[model samples]
Target: MIKLELIVQVHQLKKQGFKVAAIARKCNLSRTTVYEYLEMDFEEACRWVNELRTREKKLDPYKNQILSWLKEHPDLSASQVSDWLEERCSFTNVGDSTVRSYVRELRELYHIPKTISFRSYEALEELPKGKQTQVDFGEKKVRTTKNKWKKLYVIAFVLSHSRYKYAEWQEHPFTTRDVIRSHENAFEYFGGVTEEIVYDQDKLMIVSENGGDIIYTEEFQAYKQQRGFSVYLCRAADPESKGKIENVVKFIKNNFAKNRVFHQIESWNEQCLAWLDRKGNYQVHNTIKKRPIEVFTLEKLHLREVSYPLSFESNHGSSITRTVHKDNIIKYKSNRYSVPLGTYKPHGDNTVYIRIEQEKLIIQKTPEGVTVATHPLSTGVGQLIKNSDHTRDKSKGIKAYMDTVKESFDNSEEIELFLQEIHKRYPRYIRDQLQIIQRSLRDYGPFVEQALDTCINQRLWSANDLHDVSIHLAKLSEKEIPAVLRDIPLTEASSELIKEKASVRELDGYLRILGGA
Candidate 1:
């Protein structure tokens, strides 16, 4: 079939005294095909082409295979299918545009959706004043927010009853410290905190969930005591329960964000705070039908008043133990710091207790807790923190080396039990397994001791099993360090309070003595 314009051109060429063969050659068509259009009008040409163009397409051969693939993997995209055809099915000539068009038509014919749909939920009931507040985090990409396109996260806190909202923006993801600090600011913004606050199972707060049990993060568990409030974690996979905060996150992005200009993040935060005062909290809420500031009056009565910001203080005379390596060094937070050359005997029985005193690393002898070495804590990870005096006497005598080996294999109950169990259970491989345990101890120190105990108790047969257990335990130990003071119940208010207070005083006394020295 030929185009109407081509038919007109052919007739025009024929009228110019050109032969049918000449017209066919000039128009790039067969003489017989050119004759079909020579005497036809424009409408007749279009009708002729339309009549036969409905014939089968090249994709008809693989229609069944493509449909089966789409049904099995709804997420498989058109371009991906095209690439799959090129590589797997030898359909190298297949175009993405053709595939997409066919896929769209297939979707319409088969009732297959292009994307998954979620049911939108709206809150029907409202909790009483101070009974609940919702919390969540949101991210935004902004062009004017910084000198370049910047990605920022906003932590939003919303009162479920009053609809009062508090939001803080940061240039980076919210860390545990940032979460605690944001709560302080939010409470201050609302003038107090609710009795029970709802959360979206955020990692900064919730560590893990087992069935119905929720394990809060180590730092947040401490903050719960300091601030004295009930924590309400939303169920996993149930996003609808925390709908209020989610909407607040969107409201912030839309009203305060769209078409808005920003120069600095700090200035943006200040602007956000001002906007909340003038527009966010001040405006009449669509659901509650009252200003958040006015509704907060009733909620404020049940809310907890803040006397001080409840932030996690890492250590207060608390200690963490690490084993010294053969190189007269110990590992802490990805950095290695040196101890005295003879500090670690090959025996590996000795332990070092580190107290993070302000900005300094106070390394002390375990059991006695005597200050043995100190170095300013390293600022960067993967760095070697060294003290020249600690490296003296690298060339010790043979007897000294023998004694070093003897000391390492002594004093550890964990190592002793591991050897005993190895001898009783697998006497033939005892030497090899003992060597593995010693290697684990030299590398991981006291951290691997608990794992060895678990491995022995469980009768795990191989050295690799013990090593795996040790590594798992080491990770848990690291997670335990976002420290806060443990809360002891004050039954005897005066006496129990003194005990809690005493720990802080003890830390102070140690610091004072060190300060004098």
Candidate 2:
């Protein structure tokens, strides 16, 4: 074996800028042996110099396999082929890396392909606080309960100055609404919006028809107005603006999402968000030389607060009904959305509007400027709606309204009798009229209904879950169902008692239980 003394001398001499010939003279070795020692790793060089050594035993086997693979795919590179072999076969004596070198030499002997040229872009030197953010999406192939290959998109945002990141999963083929909602949610998450949002010309927000004028869809523009931020599209095909987000997507995929197998998109999504909070946010940014939280705390202090009060309502539901629950609460998104307790319910025919503000549910009587009860965010799905059918009369009130909601062949008297019972159970003044309005809900789609069911069953019901579900449905492009559909029972056979206490299964049970109750 080549002695440790010789290896040390060679490295030391090289460090001091000694030529190979000079070092060989001092070491009493031939120039070729000295040069070979320099090129090889210390352990290997020592072994070679001490004795005439045969090649690693597994080298020849790997060489044959590599050549066979390369002959079929001649353009394959060293790293690519090595990775393929590592996964399929295991060699006791040789590392995949040892195989890599043999393949490199074989390619050179045949004068085969070379590494492709890669263009390096110039990077900005001095990014300032809150001035820029990088954004990008990553995707993973998932097999849904339907046994289809579904692609899940995750959007990652990194504030350039702080390296603070936010990530959320989205369905593929981004839509105008998806783009807008994501921005709004991100702003709410960060507690405020930065002045500039750096993005690629994702088709949702960009119009190619007018000289590539970056025209946000009307909804997106309204969202931007609500937050007061500007959108910056990157140069066509250039990814540098959002490089931070791009790198983070890969980092999260490898470190966090890699080991997890998800039954529903929501499960994966919740884990992803939790991972960002626990791991990514707390880790220090390599280039920034400071922790992201440290930078965010400082940057947040400098941002301008909104001058006027803006309503950040969910796309799902804002319309309200006048009926109040016996517990003095109103229901929205599976939780008890409360209105002001002392407010009076008017006797005339009128509608109320329910709005979400800063995570609180607000109910206002329209045109009358009357403020009703307000509730803090709810914790369960069943609390969002009660039996609103009891408020109206059977003979003159809820009897007619029930006819519209029941899907039946009856222009018949029996249907009217059923409506009469519904009206009688829920008096016209409290529950009946509200149930009529609740029965009329048809604005959201099936996927959301399923997602809410998941949330409720898992006991993870929150504004965040509802928000995430709405966004998730919008991405799928399914027809809208009423946001309050869950208030209605999935099957008449299910008892009111069991249905009333229904809990959420988070995302794990969503696929199985998605009958939309």
Candidate 3:
């Protein structure tokens, strides 16, 4: 028997001019089942569904036993019921769906509603000032100025002691580089770095966790070493360990990003910062019973001072060497600024000299000091500031590079249309978008084709959307998502760095606590 919801969906798709096979694929139903449902009218389909529900189910023999179990454990799930049946009665040959359907019928007939079990939690003791900060990521779809929906990603940071929050938004899924940049921005906003930072088991930072041994990604490992902060990764399935940022992530989505019209990434972030100033930080916190900004003022004293490399100063500074990434870009102040094409060498040194002078970022070739690129520095996080000319090869030109990217896909015409839409949306950064698509093809391979179809059908015109769809498809197929990895060893000092520190109290405070002062 088919679900009434599936029957209704079949009829709706048929009205929408979808072919039978396409409907089958969309609904994950067999052609025969679809045909059987398509032959019935709405009333006939309702009758058929009701008749099937009343029919004797395979687990009807143990109906009373299941009901008694539900009475004892009101939060028991269908899957658990099926498992109990197999274990207690040695039941076999019944499909999971069959058991699920029968359990639903029993619940409805007996008026036994499923109850949700809530986990009990205790309020943890507050951390000492500047002891730790928690980080988390969140994404939401918001209405653009054109009234179309666009997805935005945000990384949130919350100081564990004061809950002083800082969040940054982007138009794309964050890479490891983006995560590092956000960390820098968070530290700058808080005026200093904490002794330790807590994080979830995010792939951007962590590569794998075997037993208690944690393996961080190569880029994150380098950043961790440079920043001199300890990292405490929460165990898998335990987000409550770092519940501060989890609540902050929800607070950002609900209070700021919710119902907000996104004009552009830069402006959206500007609005978020303004919101933080007025409402998010200024308002009284429910748990701490004080304003975050006020608590942060005192907590700021205990924080470690921000450090920078001796090679360069940030404000109107002398040049410092920065490694050019494979995408012909270098990081400056949490944003990626572009360099000329072919600057990144696969087999040789790819370092370039960068400096800030009079509010402009200058990129020059090393030793010779020949200028390669220059741009006004960006104030936003995760922005890709590119010069169109820098992405163009003198011989091939931009059009030829676009064609080369499109030809790499199976459906060149569709890919061309998608690329053209991306060009229209992001005229200045079309080359970077195209390079992202090329990388997706190299990484996701054949899955990129399906992802393209999804993007085109849904009218998603960004490379990030295409990349996200490809990852979704890859996960659905149980295939491993490809990523860059290195065999960097975790040193003993870093491993031991995450141990919790004991808070010390003054003798005067102890005397007062004992009422003997």
Candidate 4:
């Protein structure tokens, strides 16, 4: 194309009586095409030359803008720039082909100047089994209930030798808490530990950047110090250093998350785990020729035992605004948790640290780290509470029951009565039921009385219901007691009621006779 353009220019010069050899020397075209153009009529020659190069000149305007953008943002390539221009400015004259050609031309002109430097990655000569693992976050497209598309982040890990992969959807924000929790979960799932973990330099881990120095986040540094696991971070913007984990991320997303239908993030994660065990690890890898599970079994012996006792505190270090409601409940994550009255502003913001474990929230004073309160998982939008000591105490009723037992009967007699009563009441083995009742007594305190009352009223013994009700009582505030007790109708039954009812299990039968259940 360049030679043809030069030939036309040289031939035009020759028509003005310049020597063909001189034209060739100046324009860098061969003498042959230049002579042909010179022999042709001006109209025919111009038409032939334009046919060869007209499209390029036609897109010159749009191509210039694309070149300018690429110069401004060197990281952006021609196609990306073309898409941007197409959306924002509707650069009508340039197509993708033209943009590509212009980029090629620019690169040729400034080849040496625009070259990017990359550090060569060395292949691992031999990795001891379970000696190292690599971690990364992979994104997959998921649809919301409204059918809108969103990217879900999954944490991906790969064992160095076995190439065994583990992945789970990260339902929470990518925070230091999330990172630590993911590590714990992965370790538990793998049933072992690796000596070293290679990680991306996530912001949660790298707190600050000072030239070539990276300051680790306080939470991450604490974890490393306590756990005794060596940390290796990939160089900034270099993902290939952790290529095994990167490939695991791609494989899990494509094979597991992409193929499944899920209603919740947790459900998707669980499905991925099951799929990894059954379909992914069980199948022979195309390159490795052995099943991942088989390879992992061989490598498991090489993994080091977890070096230190595992104990973790929540990284609740966040700037939170305490929102107070009229009901004295502070809202978090669409559910209501209680705070001391007048400590928070109505419709205003105050900072607090909320340490979450599973679904439980432990609200704490920010600077002091003193536990202000703990809340069970909330059911709905609000809670009603009174200011009291933050400690959860449920021993009052149990102590009262023990005192009554002690006072009313001989020690041996009371023990025999309790055992015989429990054995007679339960259809299954009594020991499990006794343990369940004991746990409920500890958790529910006096509210265990209500659970007992529920059992007595229904003439049924249910350990599961006792446990569930105790948990429910732990979540309820003093204000909710009146309403809950009223709903259960437990306190006011008379001897007449007992005589009329015959048995607690018959209450439902009685209700059924009255067309209620």
RMSD of each: 28.7, 26.2, 34.6, 23.6
Best by TM-score: 1
Cα lDDT for residue 246, candidate 2: 79
The reply for model 4, stretches above 4 Å from the true place, is: 1-122, 144-146, 209-214, 307-517
Pull out the clashing pairs in model 1: 346-404, 347-407, 347-408, 347-409, 348-408
Q: Kindly list the per-residue Cα lDDT of model 1 for residues 5-79, writing each as its tens digit.
A: 788899899989999977887899899988888768877778876864566777778888888988988877888
Candidate 2 overall lDDT versus native: 0.61
Candidates in order, TM-scores: namely 0.47, 0.40, 0.46, 0.44
Candidate 3 Cα outliers beyond 4 Å, as residue runs: 1-75, 78-120, 309-517
* lDDT per residue (tens digit) for residues 239-317 in model 4: 8888888888888888777635557876777788888999878888776788989999888877766544355434332
Residue 243, model 1: Cα distance from true site in angstroms:
0.9
Superior candidate under TM-score, 1 versus 4: 1
Q: Rate the local accuracy (lDDT) of all candidates.
A: 0.76, 0.61, 0.84, 0.67
Model 3 C-alpha RMSD vs. true structure (Å) is 34.6
Task: Name the TM-score of candidate 3.
Answer: 0.46
Query: Please, what are the lDDT tens digits per residue for candidate 3 over residues 1-517?
Result: 4488889999899999998987997899898988998999989988987888678777879988999998888788999998999999899879899888888877888888999777899977899999999999999989898977888889999999998999999875676666777788888899999999999998778878888788887768888988899999999999989888999999999999987888998899999999999998999999999999999999999999887632212331233556688888988766899887888765444556767779898888753477889899888989999987876565356688898887788887898899889988986687789888888888898799999999999999999999999989888776433332234566889678757578898899889989995
Model 2 misplaced regions, further than 4 Å = 1-106, 110-115, 142-150, 171-173, 209-212, 265-267, 306-312, 317-517
Q: Estimate the TM-score for candidate 1.
A: 0.47
